[model samples]
Target: MITPRFSCSQNEESVVVKIYCPSVRASDIEINVDDTLFTVHINPYYLRLNFSQSLLEDDESSAQYDPSSGYLTVTLTKAEKGQVFKDLDLLSKLLAPRLTEPPPGNPIIEVLDSDDAADIQTDEDALVQATESLTLEQNEILEAAESDWQLKQEVPEPLSSLRTSPTDRYGFLDSYSGYFTHVEHTENEVNELGSEAETLPKSDRRKHRIEHEEKKWDEEYYLADYADGEHIQELLCWRHPHLQLPDVSYTPEEELAMLNLPRKEYLASPLQTRQLYLTLLTLLFAYAYESRTTQHDPTPESGWTLGILIPAFSALDPPPYTDKSTNDPSTFSIEEVISTFVASYRRSLAFPLYRSFALAESCRSDVASFLSKGRRMVLRCLLEMKYILDHHDVYYVYSKIWIDDFCVWIQANASDETLHQLGSLICSLKIPKADIGWDLEELEALVSNSEVGREADSDDESEDEVERMLPTPL
Candidate 1:
């Protein structure tokens, strides 16, 4: 009989096992606990033995045992904890059956053991053989490779020789040399052409000299004789006979014409001619006065009368009055006649009319002097005229000359009484009606308010009163 008991415990590090077997002593029984069999520390072999013992003790269990071989087998109709024991039992039965059974046939195991040992020995020998063969093959390959490398090295030259030649290489180099030679030849040609071109200017100079000489010969041959000496005389004769003729004296008519005198027929009646000449003289005098007085320079001498002195003398001598009239003109005063003639002269000589006269020879000296003075008077008159024309609306042409001249004359020549009388005369003279074209009342108001006039009037009145108060001068 066999009895078995089992227990198990666990800690942090491993499992602890306790087993009790009554059939076997602990010392004789082996506790082969394959550490690999369970992750826990339970001994599997011991476990199996214990399981088998337990299964055998169980009620209704059918098991077979071989005590001689120390083997047992169990069969399970249902699985239980004791089934683990049956599984071990089956392994042991299969591996270690009764020794009484005939030895089982396992020729494959026998052959595999023998063959494996033989194969190992053969593989060792084959390895050595293969190493030796590889060494020999490598040596052969190295030799063949070296031979091939040398053959490759010698192959290129023959191929290159077959394709081209040294002469062909030289020909390529010579092509560039030929091009440079052509360039050099062209440079030589250009230098030769330049040398040829340098001579052209000298040739042109020679041709120009020839042409100039030919032109000089042609001019001398064709034109010089006709233009000089006798040809010029012939041209002159053709153009004008007088150009070559000698100088000649003037005839009377030509002389008279040159002098621009009246014709003989007109001069035959001395009186009428003299009157005409006087008229001419008067025109000339007016012209001279007008030209001399103006700011512009006079016109040319030809524009004036020719032979003026004799013509004017003949005209003005034996004055146009009879002896009675010369002694005294009854109809008009000499002053009136002189004034009329002067007025006529002034009219004729006004702008846009030009005449010439011989006043220097014709007029009496005193009259000439008076005429000369009258020129300045006429300039003053013209100034007054311009003022009148511009200021036609002004009431008066105030005579500053009268006041200015009277002031100076009184200072030089008058007594106080005479000065007073002169001042009174100046004050009493009525403003001219012709001059008072505009604003007379305004002018009168201005004069009435004049301080200077008032002062003078006061002084005059005081003097007059003083004189009246004294004894009469009788």
Candidate 2:
């Protein structure tokens, strides 16, 4: 049965699902709503959707079909009125079944609304009025206690004080502005993919994504990016000297774009999952290294990288696991791994500063050889991913999901190649023009210096305060 094209929208009380299915008799339609799951069936078309919130089918629930337009519009009341529903237009995610068993629950924290804030303010005012009646001696004692408490509190790491001018309002550091241009385009290609996907049928979304992924790769672009090794040299040679990377926070719009990223879980055994993660790590390394070579900075394609790579992993949302036999012992195919790598690598070449065909034939051979090496080269790939994810703040989520676990796994399974050897091999294992420049020792020293500087400054402040408190010799 075809998954009919659909669109969803919501108001305070109800969700409107518009499905396009023509020539179906009204009597032939079957609509079922069980808690958060909704199913619609009409002879040749079927759709099952899972919503973030429970839905209610009551007297107010209605289905209207427009024979002229071949559209079926179903309106269902929300279980909790006035509750806002999110990601309604994300058809692919909505069609994906919930995990077989829910992930472990986290502690629930109550969010304070305006009324709660007002009540808290009233209590604070009362306490302030009561405190005003304290004697000067009591106030002094309280002040001293507060001072001690403040001193005991942990100090936050100091931001880089090296910038002579004020910090840029944008995310880029003042010093790095000359090195990189800060593009103000708020809409990233990834968020645009999610928005554009809303109108497509569930069946077509994956195909659309596959085609889109394929279009990102071009041999000429890759060779062009490969020819200029300056960015690659920079990546291989210099490490940022700051513990907290300068201005790593995403702008408000960028954060929203990230939050809007499509999230779909897939069914894979622990082993297959680890392999998938490893493959993703390698792809990430190529992307990080190539983006630096092509764009001089990786920030521009950050979301786009996630957009392409994540869909490859979650391309097919596993069906609801009702039967035990659905769990099969299988592994990710090499073709799939290579496809993911190509998808990631292609994106890095998409917006290059230049392109060269002089070595296209040789570059193709090099890419083929890189893939043929397989597990032989993954060690260096893993090391490269660790270096970038360790320092880069934006890809921290990937680090948590893939890189961190992969690191632990690598540690548990020691190989003949030491980390230093593998890291050095990463520089030599360049694909035509790809080499990484992350040094662990240099990064460690920078972090150490950052901490020591903070401690020295704190000690000096404490000493100055003590001297001021002491009596002056007259």
Top lDDT model: 2
The alpha-carbon root-mean-square deviation between model 1 and the true structure, to one decimal in Å, is: 75.3
lDDT of 2 by residue, 1-474 (tens): 877777788998899999889998988999999999999999899988888899999999999999999999999999999988765643445766665875666978887766688889999999999899999988987998987744346879998545353322111010111111221233333322343322333345556655654565455444434445455454444332211133222234322322232344544445544344434434444443443333424454443454334442222211111122213223333333333343334434443333222222223333333333333233333444444554544444344444444433332232323333323333333232231112323434565677789999999999999999999999
The number of clashing residue pairs in model 1 is: 3
lDDT of 1 by residue, 184-226 (tens): 2232211111222222232333343234323323222222332
Per-prediction backbone clash count:
3, 5
lDDT of 2 at 401: 46
Best by TM-score: 2
Model 2 alpha-carbon drift over 4 Å, by segment:
102-265, 269-474
